[model samples]
Target: MSQQTSILILDDEPIVSKRLRPSLEKKGYEVETFTSSVDALARVRERKFNIVVTDLKMEGVDGMQFLTEVKSLYPDTEVIVITGFATMATAKESFSKGVFDFLAKPFKLGEITEVIAKAEEKINNS
Candidate 1:
């Protein structure tokens, strides 16, 4: 049997994790959601995930730092940045820092799924 794709989701809002976990799981991913970036980073240290979906603004250890750390530690792990406070600068920064995709907040589920699909393809190909 094929192994399930493992996904880590980090967002300060509980509702975002609540909503995304099941949807991603339905698509055959092993999804773990976190409202705390610090805790999520701890988990990331414990094991590598195939993908990480994170919000840019958080109380501690914001997305940019998290993205930088993750890319440095696990270059193969694909990261997708989601932020309500989307700016061209932030988007450009995310891309430059090596995020697989950047998503603006209040996004549709379909949009996220599509991005995940692309990330999955990359994971499989590599």
Candidate 2:
């Protein structure tokens, strides 16, 4: 097997993380899912992930703050935002922070996979 793409998924809801972890791992990506942003941030500090998928809303350290820190630590790492409360302002703000993509909640698995494919392509090309 080839080197697997490492991904960190952060969502407050356990169901969200549970649902995504298996699918992403099945795609041959190394996956870590976190329901807590604090733990997620600590994990990121220890190692850099190739891609990060985060929810816009969370208890501590919201998605914007999380992504900002990720970019600072590893500017090349691609970030994808998934939000239940998607808004134009948030989308624009996310883009300005250099997020690779933004997705609304209740999306199909295919949608996220497609975005991951694109992010992986960019990672490879870079």
Worst 10 residues of 1 by lDDT: 19-28
| lDDT tens digits, residue span 1-68, model 1 | 99999999999999998989989888889999999999999999999999999999999999999989
lDDT (Cα atoms) of all candidates against the true structure: 0.94, 0.95
Superposed Cα deviation of residue 51, candidate 2 (Å): 0.1
Q: Each model's TM-score?
A: 0.98, 0.97
Q: What is the alpha-carbon RMSD of candidate 1 to the true structure?
A: 0.7
Which residue ranges in model 1 land beyond 4 Å of their true spot? none
Q: Which stretches of candidate 2 lie over 4 Å from their true place?
A: none
Count of steric clashes across candidates, in order = 0, 0
